[model samples]
Target chain A: MALTRDDVEKVSLLARLQLTDDELNSMTEHLSQIIQYVHQLDEINTDDVAPLAHTLDITNVLADDVVADCLSREAALQNAPQRDEECFRVPAVL
Target chain B: MSSPETQPMGGTPYAVVVGLEVHVQLKTNTKLFCRCPTTFGQPPNTQTCPVCLGLPGSLPVMNRHAFELSMKTALALNCTIPYFTKWDRKNYFYPDLPKGYQTSQFDLPMSEHGHLNIFSENDEFADKQIRILRAHLEEDAGKSMHDEAAGVADSRIDLNRTGTPLLEIVSEPDMRSAAEAKAYLQELRLILLYLGVSDCNMQEGSLRCDANVNLHIDTPAGTIATPIVEIKNMNSFRAVQRGIEFEVGRQYTLWQKDKQVLGDMPKQTRGWDEGAQVTRAQREKEESSDYRYFPCPDLVPVVVTDEEIQAMQQQIGTLPASLRKQLLDDHQLTAHTSAVIVNQGLGFADYFLALATAIDDSRLAGNWMQGEVLRILNEQEQTIQQFKLSAAELGELLKFIQSGDLDNSKAKDVFAVMIESGQSAADVMAELGIEKVDSSQLEELCQRLVDNNPKIVADVQSGNPKAVGALIGQARKENSNVDPGQVRQICLALIEKL
Candidate 1:
């Protein structure tokens, strides 16, 4: 299926991406090609096979519920774009 | 019952359909995928780690206890537990979401196809079944507190709540009215609390709910279905009921204006204007997102063996509903009284049970607990665990009342002193000089009072029965430990002879 301009625009908005009008047209064509190439597997359907969710065959990779040292308040806010003394600051959010 | 003018939709009588999504934070020691402490009201960002902060190359490892707790909840809810389950990433953009994606259980939830029995508190529906669509496990995002202190323009994010284990339970649209919805939420919270999996305190944000509501209007043409609107920002169960009630009426009125609003209208998202007491539209429902869900490369699917499931089932113990019924049937307590005892946390309920066992009078024990114990808890701001009086001591006090050694009013005074001094009933009674006067002593005291107060005796002789009240007060003052009713009887008998 060919990806339309509207489809690309909608996804871009969901991804919080800003694109110009010229970039929107080219991105739609490129995404359509990528999706088409991936959809080729649909042509050769092995009905007997099972769908794979993980590449590894292992399951239940778990850790015991134990606490260890964590990052301090200062270290956690070191790389924040904006921060107060003890919290990360950002534009007003609702 | 509503009057014709107060009826919904100008007396159109539309049917309301409601579904609920309840989010409860699991009471685990650490975060779901990290070692950060899941402590509430901590200093901001102090509980952060590389994995929870979504730093580069950080991997996630599932907390085994969180998964076990989730399985226990599923089993308690009568849900079908899947043998195999995996996590998926739900993508979204929010200031509080550091990873921009939440690790959640998608298509395959932890449990599904369950039903919660809601006994309407006062609604006409005797007992309703609210179907459960799914219950999934996820991690909570941090909170963004708007309008920082000192009139700061920016918002502040607290990461202490980030990465906490959360279980999202979704219910089918089986609720017909706001009362039924509130009952369903109350029952669900009670079950979770009894299971000891969550605190379920809405004020502290440990438990939250969002409701999806719509209306169905029956007309001459046909039945019209209104677009579903999801409501958020209800902080309490009462707010939830009121919010759904307001939304149901609002939708009916909106649909009456234009029939075209039903078809092809996108589902809307609204916020409960708590102060305004109305549901305000925030935005039109956007197209569903392509979350691009896939199993996390770092974590593997969870495989639960039958043995583990059986163990979890055993851990659930006796449910609160069964205990409430037992208290009603075996102990002959009222349903309302049983609920009050059961909702006082497990410790209080167990204490009452011990007292009931020690004394054969469960009703009286329950009354004392509900009246005196809870009053003290409220006044002193103490919990059942912090209550000083032991269950045995309380039982002994009740025995004193039963054997006519103490009256009900005197017992309350002793209870207060016992709680203050942490002393036994016998000790407090002795310290306060409280004891029952013998019948002979009471009779003698009444004879003395009647002989001394001739004016009151003449009034009593004239057959004014209430005139004897003063003689009873005089008897109490003379002994300070006489039952007033006994005093009245003895005083009237003495006056009859006079």
Candidate 2:
């Protein structure tokens, strides 16, 4: 089943989006249409079909057990949106 | 065992049912479905590209290597691969996602129906086996970093991790306790690590756990239950364990009241609050939150043939399980000991297995390698490769022990020298001048030492001994080359005269 109008509105709100009414209507419609398309999987006769988890067949490719060379705090925070003398700063991301 | 099952949510008596969806990041050189770099902790936006940044008009192309690595992982987990598989657009909005939606697998995932074996603390608990429901490929979202200030004042977003290829492995709610769920997750992480599919680093958000916890109750009529809580934001295994435990108790408390308050046949989602030490309700768990999933028209469906599966399987070298089994039987190692050696990742296991194959005794090698070798590696904070003791070289040193060229004491001495300076064991034996003296020379030395100490000889003769120890120590120093065992024999013979 596709997402309902309520689901879209709720998720959009949770995401703190500034969606217009038209955008909400359209997103709801487009999302429903996509879900309808995904419903085709129901027709694939997967009763005996198992779900696939990983595409790779290989197991265990461990890196050489080496201690990580750490970066300096300044180097680590170089690209921060904002940085104070002590650390990276940014707009409230929550 | 005598207690009634506590129901999840608000129902009757029930047992907490836990299903874990583990997100593992493939340790590929690049990101999934994109050519962007997949290095974690990279500079923000440095690894971003048109496809990964989800820019308008930028078409998505599949990274064949990521797909192949995913396939190999699924096969190793014994998951059934779909003959036809494709990616879907999972519509969601978050600060982390540059695009409004994420690209992930929907109804048709990469692998399914596998099983993972888990080992728990050795007590009353039997080893547990968890069922793998499915594994799907998806792209990760960017991180939302909070400000260091008190209260949630400011936060930052880092897009460097966005578009990292992730394989989300969902497991059946077969685990009864949080411990089992934890063990399953641990074993799963090890398997993925061994498979080389995902680095599965939780600290960098490589491997994360989102647990779907509910409870099953047995009543006089039937088992009644409560709503399921989907717990999130657990950063580590300890968090996973405690989170599940808290959810179990919370659900049990709710169930003790009436169970049906949350409504039957409905599941709810919850988030874990580390400070609260309790799971808080996030939302009424969507029965099946429709994501509007669809096959991405941009990328072609992944087509893996039988030969490819077999090829991937061929790439699946000996993992911890099979190797542990073989080591248990072929070598003198106990199953517990073998499991320890095997559980220590394939590299360490490889070193031991290679050494075992080259040498006649796996028991001795397992003991020394698992104990001494691991201690050395940990003390150096280095890998087995850097330990200066190659598999063959370590095996040769063990052979020295078997040939009596080195005793247990001297073997440890030579091993220490070999490890510290990267010198050969043979060279250490020679350089340290620890080679055993000939039996005749050792006997003569012991005879002289005993003749030099008549009181010690008399004490051994009168059976007030331990005097023999002083004589052996004296003789070893006198010749420094004397075989301690031969000197002991000569000392006994000299004491008989007294």
**Per-residue lDDT of candidate 1, residues B318-432 (tens digit):** 6778888889999999888888998787788998899998888999999998999999899989998888888998998899999888989999999888878888888889988
Q: Estimate each model's TM-score.
A: 0.91, 0.79
- How well does each candidate reproduce the native contacts, as fnat? 0.93, 0.17
Highest TM-score model number = 1
Off by over 4 Å in 2: A1-93, B1-14, B148-154, B257-268, B271-287, B441-471, B481-498
Best of the candidates, DockQ: 1
| DockQ of every candidate structure | 0.81, 0.13
Candidate 1 segments whose C-alpha is farther than 4 A from its true place: A91-94, B1-10, B122-125, B147-154, B260-263, B443-467, B489-498
Give the CAPRI class of candidate 1. Answer: high
**Model 2 chain B poorest 10 in a row by lDDT:** B1-10
- Model 2 C-alpha lDDT per residue in residues B1-498, reported as the tens digit of each score: 333354445544556678999888877666665656777776555566666656678876666677777888888888999887877777665667777778988888989999877765464246667788998888888777777766757666666677777888899888878888888888888888788777777877789999988777677777655677789989889999999998878776766676563466566767878888887777554334545556566666666788888888999887777776788777768877787787778888888878888777778888887788888888989977677878998888898888767777778888988888888888888899877566677666776787788888778888866678888788766666566776777688767765
